[model samples]
Structures are given as C-alpha cells and as structure tokens.
Target: MEKRLLDYLQKILNARVYDVAIESRLDPATKLSQRLGNQIWLKREDTQPVHSFKLRGAYNKMVRLSPDELARGVVCASAGNHAQGVALSARRLGCQAVIVMPVTTPTLKSDAVRSLGGQVILHGDSYSDAYAHALELEKKHGYIFVHPFDDPDVIAGQGTVGMEILRQHQHPLHAVFVAIGGGGLISGVAAYIKAVRPEIKVIGVQMTDSRAMLNSVTAGELISLPDVGLFSDGTAVKKVGQETYRLTRELVDDFVTVDTDAVCAAIKDAFEDTRSILEPAGAMGIAGLKQYIAQHNLRGESLVAITCGANMNFDRLRFVAERAEAGEEREALLAVTIPEERGSFRRLCETIGPRNVTEFNYRISHERTAHVLVGISINNRGEVPEIRRSLATQGFSALDLVDDELAKEHLRYMVGGRSQLNANEQLYRFEFPERPGALMRFLSGMHPDWNISLFHYRNQGADYGRILVGIQVPPADLATFRTFIDSLDYRYVDETQNPVYHLFLC
Candidate 1:
C-alpha cells in the first residue's frame, strides 16, 4: 500500500497542470474557525481560472497526450466543472475539444464551457448518459478520450491539492476534507497525504442523498444508486469509478454525508468568511466538517476543507437562503394553535418572550381555533427544545417545524382555511421525479374517488418536483387509498397528522 501510494504521490509532484491550473490559496476561514473552536483553513479552488479544481486534472491528462493524438482532438463527458476545465485546457493547448454534458447541467456552467472555446453537445439527463454518448463519439471520430475522474492521470493531477496544502500549512493538521463525486479528488488527495503526511486524516464528503462513493465504500464493492439527488448537481453521480474506489478504500481515513440544508448553511458560512458564494457541491466539505466536529465533539484542531467550485446558479441562491437558517439551527419554525378569543395574539407573543420573530403567518381555521405559523431566531440547536417546552408549559399547542419537510417546503407558504365541506381528507407530501409527464402520471395513478383537494408546488432548482397534496377519500376507501400509495413509484410521506395541516387545512 505504501509503495503504491508513493508511486501516485510522485506522479502528483510531477503533474504538469500549472500551465492552466494556478495554485489556489489556502485562506483562513476566520469566522468559522472562531465559531467551531478550530483553525479552519479553506483551500480556495473556487478562485481557479475556471472557478474549479477540475482544471488541474483535466489539463494534466490532456497535456500528457502525444502531439499526434492532440491533433485528432479530445472528447469527454462531464457534469460541469470538468467540462469547463477541458474547454479551457483545450483553448490553451490549441486543440479542439468536444464536451458532452447532461441536459440537467446548468446553463450557467454550459455557457462557461462554451465561452472557453469548446464545442458543447447537450446529451442525456445525467453524467452517465453523457459519458455513453462521449464513448460513441470517441469511437466514431477516433478522438482522444479525457475521462473526468476514472483515469490514473486525472487522479494524480488532483493529488496536487494535497501537495499544496502541506506546503501552505506546517502546523499539525487534524484532517483535510474533500468533496467526492466519482472519488477522483479524494482518491488523489488521500494517496498523496497518506504517503507523505500520514498523520493528517483525509476525509471524504458527499451529499447524503447522492453518495455513490460513501455507499460503495460501506458495501466493499462498487454499487450504482437507482437515482441521485440533483440539488448539488455537480456531485450527483450515481456510480463510483473503479480505480477511484480502489484508491479510496486503501487511502481515505473517513467519510461523512451531509444534507441539502447543511450544504446551504455552509455556503452562507463561506460567504461570511470570504465574501465568495460557492456552489452546493463546493460547500459540501465544510458542511461535513461541521457535522463531524459536532458528532465527535472535537475542538482546537487544525483542519482544511477544499472549497472546490463557485459556478453557482444565481436562481438557486433564494432557495439556499431559505433553508440555511434552519440547517444552522439559527431559526426555529413552529405551528402554534391558539383559541380565536380576544387577546390571544398578545398572550402568544408574551409566551414567545422577547426572541426575534423571523416569520409569521396567521389564518382563522374556524370560529374556535386559529393556526399561526411562525419562525423565531434562536442562538443554537438547544434553544429549539427550550422554546418548545416553554410553549407547552404556557398551554399552547406547538409543533416543531425544523425537521418537517412538508411544512418548510410548502405549507408555510399556503395558509388557507380548512375544507369545511370536504370529508376525510388526507394530506401527503410527494417528491415527483423531474421529468416530462410526471404530474400527468401522478394524476392518472390516483383513483377517481380520491379527489385532490389542495396542491402547491414550486421548483427549488433541484432534480425532484416537490408538491403538497390533499386528497378527499371516503372512509370506506381508506384501504384502497393506502394500497394505491404503496403501488406508486415516487417517494412520499403522509402528512395528515402534521400539526400544521390540522391548523391550516384540517
């Protein structure tokens, strides 16, 4: 293992990527360091010319090709970053590059690649599809193929990040966190770090819903995920690379998975420290780092996290901002019901105390009870339970909304009165696949007797479609309704017992 890692480390030390890939700075995350009680160093790969660390691997691999192969051009498939890196490298090397990208790849990224002089071909829905299309093109045109992360040269090139980190910081390090997609970055970094600075841990980070590498590592074999989340679209790979996986199993020290809300909070944290907005995949390292520290109760350790890219879609920032507070436990959302009598509102506010109210929505459900959806600022995660206990002691029925997906995503936006006429309505939150005819399929799959009473949907710049649905089912058809739900393919959660539903639409 040492000999193999040393071989990769030597390749990394000699990787020819500096022609297009600059040495990104290891900047101090002052605010995060102070808050976490650790020295948090951010490897600013977001400052690369193409705004990603991918350039190092892409350029190194392409530059290694013979002049004859270069003249024939190069082809590759990528989610976004590697496409941009290849495009920029091609432009620098005076070679033609054909980049096949998934249709779901953001226009913000595709446009960046095109601006770098690469001929862009929009392919299937995901990177795997694009890779297949690239393979066909590679055969037809006899072009040199540039694999994004599966190739040895790419992994070795990415190892340059570890080399630079050790050079920048001489202090005893705790860990270096790298976000994994197909595992190229971590494979390379782990090899180099373990070979030279074996004391420092090499941690891999992944989005919880799309963790091909983490799942594969756990299973001790490569496994494909049926579907992957697209919120952090850059790392939404469904399969891990074989070579990358082998390297990871032997070299990586730990792996952590974080959710969308946590990644959003990490993006906000990055901005607070450096005034730079990173894409969801880029902020994953910091998110996982925060989670690891909390789980392990570690403090005063020196750590580094690679902020890998900044090609964030502008439209996605609104959604990130909405969930960031909840992820950081900076805000607590609640559904509180109060009697419709006079002075009830004032009494509710008094019960809430002087805490800053972040959001408030109120609507009368009936002549007796009114539901109020409110968001309150809190100092930490502990404050949530304290606030809930306080409300309980004051005879107010409060439902914590921090972990309620239905309430946070859709219910808070809609505050209409209960259906006085409809009978036996059941509420559900569904994650519809982001494809054509999804809504039609959902409608067709339902039984005619189950009428959809209430519905709300808004695209959160993610792969899946989220909708809050209320259906009227007669008491006799309860069994049939449950059977129909079990047959449907989409992921769903029953929200009928949710206090927010009772308050707003029961």
Candidate 2:
C-alpha cells in the first residue's frame, strides 16, 4: 500500500499540478535553535499562495480525476485553506466546483471561494455539519466528492510536505513535529517519512480540547467525540479519518496534546521568532516541540516544526493578546476583598507597591460589601509564589483567576451592568487597589442613591491601574457626586461622552 501511494504521489508530482516552487535552503534561527538546543528548520508552508500545505493535496487529487469525473465537476466542504485549494484547482482544471462551508465561516473565506470561481453553499454551524450537507449534495448532483484528508490520493499528495522537509534541511534530522486534526497531514507525512527514513521521529500534536486523533490512537480504534472546544478551530476534528488513523498508528512516533494556553504562548513565540502571526493550529507544531523537550528531556537534537497555516480571524487576536502572557505564565489574576471602610482602600494600594496592576474590576452591590478583581504581571511563572506571599502578608484575600474560564469568558463581560436610576449619576476613572473588597469600599463611600451604569476593566499588568466606572447622577446632583469623588482622594476622568463607551458599554 505504501509503495502504491508513493508511486501515485510521484505521478502527481510529474504531472505538474502545482504552480508554486518549494524552497530548499531555509535556515534555522540562532535564538530559537540555541534555546531548544536543536537544529530546528521550519518547512515554511505558510509561504505558499494560499499560505498553507492544503494546495498540494487538493491539486493532486483534483488533477487526477478522469474525464467523466471532471465533466461532472467536484464538491468539497471546508472553512478555510482546503476551500481555497479546491476552488483554485477546480478553476485551473476547467471544472465546476461547489463548496459547502459552515455559516459561521468568515466572509473573507466565503468571498475567496467565490473569487476563485467556486459556487459556495453556506450551511449549518460547524465543519462537520457542512461536511454532512456536502455529502447530500454530492449524492443528489452526482458531483465528485473531494475528500479533504482521508482519501489515499489526498494523503499521498500531502506526503509531499515530508518529502520537501527532508530535501530542504542540511543537518541530520532527529524528529519532526506535525499538528494533527483528522490526521491527514501527519498520516501522509508519517507514512512517507517512516517508509524512507524510519530513524527520524514523527511526533503529532493536537489541542487538548480537540484530540480526536490522539484519543483514537489510545483507544485502539476510532472513537467520535460528541463535541469539541474550538479555540484552534482549524484543527477541531471530533473524529479521526479511518485511513489516516491506521497510517498514524503504524507510522507516527508519538502524540502530545497542548492546552489553549500553550497554543497562545506558542503563537507569541512564533511571531517573535519569525515575525509571523500563526493561527492557533499553525502554532501547534511549535507548542509540541516545547512539550517534547520538557517531557523527554531531549536537548541538542535536530528537530523540525511545520508552521502549517496562518488563516486566523482578526477579531480573535484580541483574545490571544489578552491571554498570551498568562498562557506563558508571565502574568497572574487575583480576586481580592478588603474592608469597606475609610483608609482601608488606601492601605491596600500601599501594599501593591511598584508591582504593576494589569487589571482592576470592582462592583458594589450590598450596603457594606464590594468585590474587586485584579490581574498582576510577574517576571516569570516562578515569581507567582513570591507575589502570593506578599499578598498574604498584606492581609488581602486573593483568588487566582488565571485558569478560571468562567471569569475570563462570561463574568468579565457582565461585571458592571448594574445601575439604579439616580439624580447623581457620574462616570469617573479611578485607580484603586487590586485587593478584594476594595470595590465595596468605593461603593460604601458613595451615597445610597447613586447607581452604577457602566464598568469596563481588562488586566494588562500595569502599575497605578485605571478603571472606568459609571454612576447615575441627576442633573442637580453633579456637585454632590463631584464632592464625593474628590473626597476619595483618587484622580478622576469624566468619559460620559466617549464614543467607544457609549457604543459598546452603554
């Protein structure tokens, strides 16, 4: 089977299905290579026209269709790279292509499909749903279904990535890190690499929340997941392809699952090293490399990490930016409650000292209670211990929110919607202690009639923190609110007219 697949790949290569040329002299970065103590050569798959390795397989499969099949056209389901590949390939081959994509797929992706002359059908809400709908269209219209990663032809075509990796690197390669979803890319790469250079290790990486391939391999059979978390949406497969799983089980060296946090950290690292913004899936290979180094205690070994693709949602960058430091263990979040009395808030601020307060969120509800949430930055993961010790000595109650999903996702969004209509509503920016109960003191100090209208706080780990607070004030009560704010002895900025707050917060 392996021999037949190899011959088939060679035939596709000889047919000149791809227009892009592969680079052979790519070099390893001095900083990254030295840090990992390995000669690490990146495959640079992102350099392709579609900025992914998908084109190789899509073209290889499409170009080999018989005249009858080509006449009937072809159909596929993809949200990003695969969709682009099939669209371009279909246009070049003079065949009609119909692509089914999830409704949640971005407009940019759908537009790209149309731009390449492919008829795109938006259906369902996920890749799996789109795929099922595509199957129905394939049967009804008699269009040839182009399998994204499961077919033999597709696997053979993707094997070209492994072939290029071997030809491009100079030093002896000890290991290769590949990201896994349905296992098409890794299966192809592993089959070829193990067949030719069996000594070289082929490790696979998957996001912990979407480890279909990893779980299947461990279970000794294909096991489908009911649902998968989609932080790395491109690689969020619930089931591994049957053939891909068979090849992976036999040829792949090992598998590792990295959490969302690790993937975020790897994205930052890849950007810093290559000035490239890798999507979470693209960064999986590098995250696996870090994990492999730590797990096996292997240092100074030659390795290669495939930087797969860069088709990332622009809005998702904000989430990545917010979590990168904490994912890397360079920042920590805490919820602290302090006494709701005069000078208590000031004393809490004194305890924070020069340490930067990245975020400060406060809400006052009850007559005598306030809840304050704060995030702080540290030099490294190791510094967390010292920071905790200091907070303990300062008599502040702290609850870490670094790994709290609820706090990160929902609680932060719902923090400041509480407001009672009052004649003395005012919006003030206050720098408060990050400790707990600090918010209660702020609320306690306010008059009973005052109501909070808007609140927004994001932790950036900075010293002398700032928080936006909205309080309801009647037209005649402005002086009273101003006097109350002035007595608190904190700087205040009025942003009731800020366009951003009005549009997003109000």
Candidate 3:
C-alpha cells in the first residue's frame, strides 16, 4: 500500500495540467459555516476553464501521449463535463479530438464541445452506447481512446486537486467530502490526502439512486446498477471503473448517500453562500457534509467539500427550486383531511396559524370530508410532528407527505379537476399580500354560509400571492358574494363562467 501510494504521489507531482486548467480558489462558505456550526470550505473546481476538474485529468493523459498518438488524434465518450475537458485539452495541445456523445445529450453540451474545436458525433441513446462506438472508432482509425476516469494517468492528474486543497488550507480539517460517480475523483483525492494527512478523513458522497461505489464496497466486489437516477446525471454511473473502485475502497474513510432533495437543498445553500448555482452532482459533497455533521451531532469542526462541476441545465433550476425547501427541512408537505362542513376549512387554517403556507391544493372530494395537499414552512424537520399534532387537536388527520415523491411531483398539480361533488362551485382567482396572516385574514373574512369547494395556491417567492378558489353559493347569494369580494379590497378575477373552467373543473 505504501509503495502504491508513493507511485501515485510521484505521478501526481509530475502531472501536466497548467496548460489548460487553473488551480481554482478555495472559498469559505460563511453561511454554511454559521448554520452548521463548523468551518466549511469549498474547493471551487467548478471555476476551472471547462467549469469542471475533468480538464486536469484529460490534459494530463493527452499531454503525455507520444507524437504518433497525438498526430493520430484522440477519441472519447462523454455526455457532460468530461467531453468539454477533453475538447479544451486537445485544442490546447494542438491535436484533433473526437467526442462521441449520446443522441440524447443536450445541445448545450454538444455545442460547448464544438466551440472548443472537438468533432462531435451523436451516437446511440446512452453513454455506454457512445463509449462502445468510441472504442470501435479508436481501433479503426488508430485514435487513442481517452478514458474518463479509469486510467492511471487520469487518476494522477485528478490527484492534483487534493494537492491544491492541502496546500491552500493547513488547518485542522475533520474531513474532506468528495462526490463520487465512477469513484475517480474520490480515489485520486483519497490517495493524496491519506498519504499526507492520514488523520483527516477522506469521505465519499454519492446520490442514493446512483451509488455504484458504495454498493461495490459493501459487496466487496464491483456491482453494476440496473438503472440510475438522472437528476444528478453527472454522477449517474452504472459501474465504477476497476482502478477507481480499488483506490476508493482502500483509501476512503467513510461514505454518505444523499437523495435528490438533499442535493437540491445543498445547491440552494451553496448559492446563498457563494451566489453561484451548482449542478446537482457538484453540490453532493456539501449535502453529505451537512448530513454527516447532523448525524454525529458534531460542532465547531472544520470540513471541506469539493464543488466538482457547474455544467447545469438551466431548465433543471425550476425543479431544484421546487424541492429545495423540503430538502433543507424548511418546508413540510402534508395531506390533511377535515370535515366537509362549513367553517372546518377555516378552523384547519387556524390550526396552521402564523406559519407561511408554501402551497395548498384542495377539492370537495366527498360530501362529508375534504382532503388538502398542503405545504407549510417550518424551522426544522422536528416541526413536522408538532404541526401534525396541532392538526389532530383540531380534529384533523394529517398524513406526512414531505418525502412522498408522488404527492410532491404529480399529485399536487392533479389535486383538483372536474369535481362532481362541487356542483355549485364558482371559481375565482384572488391575489393578496404574501405574508403569515394574510391568508388567515382572507379565510376569516369570508361569509360563514359560503362553502369553499376548491382551492389552489403556490408560493411564487413574490411580494404577493395568486390563488384560485371555488366557492359554492345559492343563486340568491351571488349579489352578496360579489359585495363581500368588493369589500375585501383584494385583487380578484371572476372565472365562474370561463370556458376553460367549464371544461376542466366545472
């Protein structure tokens, strides 16, 4: 083990990466440090030339190739960060580069490689397909195949990140958190950190849905995942490389698995501290760091997390924003059932008093009762049980849906549609100030005889909130309802006779 580490250390020291990659800044996460009660540092690999640490390894391998190999060119298969890394490296080294990517690869990424002068080939439907095609081309055209994370040269190049981290901070670090996909980054980092600072724990983080390294280590052999989640697509590896898995298993001190929600929250956290949006996989290290500190109840310790990449799809930010609150335990989603009688809904609102309602969806599902899909902001996860207990005190039954993917992703939007039970329902859209008591005041001001048959609201992080509501009233009460709405002085639009409402909800 000593001799093997020595060999890697020598190679890392001699690795050539400065031609295309920079030694990125190690920035302090002040907000995270205060919140977690620990000093948190982020190694900003996302600031590299290709916006990822991949260039370090890609250039290290390509720069070492013989004249004949460089003349023949290099081919690689990548769908994300590594593709750009090789493209940038090959451009800097004055060599022809061919990057094979899945047909489903985003145009943003393929265009990025083309901008760097790499020939782009759109191949099969997945990375594995592109990889096989790249190998075929390599053999046929005498092109050197650049492995993303498997080769010794690549591993040594990535090790320089660890070297930079150690050189940047000489403080007492409790652990160094690294996100793992094929295990290459963590393997190289662990090799260096363990060799120099043996007492500092080298921890690996993986998305729960794509944890090939963790599963492989547990089984004492390589394991292939049948399918991996694509939310953190950068780290969604089916099988870790043989060399990477070996080094990771031997050198890594611990492992943590984080879910999509947690990763989203970490991205939000990173943004709060650094004002930079991190990709899901890039934020996994910070997510795992928080989990570890909380699980062990540790405080005042120093820790480091590598922000690995920033090649995020802009569209994914919407999904990440929606889940970030729940991921950080700042919001609780619940399915609350209440008696369908008049004033029961108001009482339920009173039960959730003083807390900001992040979301609410309801429809008159039955004659005697109603089910509400609600999201309430909370200080911590511990507040969920308290909220549930409060609902029970008011004769309401609440089902915790904070972790229910269906309720969060689909059921919330599908909560109310064409309810036969609400025959007399009149739909209206209302707008009011977005504040703790604003919603309560609206409920309190409604006439007691009027029955609320349906409702939909979502917090848009704006100064005011827009709500869609359905109220059931006798024909005689239409004039009074309009008068009451006018008295409230809130912005509202009458949608009772709208054709779309007639088609979808009436």
What lDDT does each candidate get?
Answer: 0.89, 0.74, 0.85
Candidate 3 ranges with C-alpha deviation above 4 Å = 418-506
RMSD of each: 2.6, 12.0, 13.0
Tens digit per residue, CA lDDT, model 2, 184-295: 7898888777766788999999988788888888999998986565567677677878899888988898888898788888888778778878878888998898889878
TM-score (C-alpha) between model 2 and the true structure: 0.77
Residue pairs clashing, model 1: none
Better of 1 and 2 by TM-score: 1
lDDT of model number 3: 0.85
Kindly list the per-residue Cα lDDT of model 3 for residues 1-506, writing each as its tens digit: 49999899888889998888899999999999998899999999989977889998999999999989899999998867889999998888899999998765656678899999999998864566778899999999989999989999999899999999999999898999999987778888888988888999999999998889999999999998876665676787888899999999899999999998999999999999999888888999999999999998989999999999887767668778988988999999888889989999899899999999988888775788778878898999999999999999999998887875545654578666776688678777876655467788888988888899987886543234658888998888889888988877666778777544552366
TM-score of each: 0.92, 0.77, 0.82
Cand. 3 TM to true fold: 0.82
lDDT of 1 by residue, 1-506 (tens): 56777789889999998998888999999999999999999999999999999999999999998899999999999989999999999998899999999877877999999999999998877788899999999999999999999999999999899999999998899999999999899998888889888999999999988989988989999999987777888898999899999999888989999998899999999999999999999999999899999989999999999999999988788889999998898999998878889998888899999999998999666788777898999988888888888887767788888888878898788877567775788888988656678799888988887888888889876656888888999999899898887777677889989866776777
> Which candidate leads the pack in TM-score?
1
Cα RMSD of predicted structure 1: 2.6
* Minimal lDDT window, size 10, model 1: 414-423
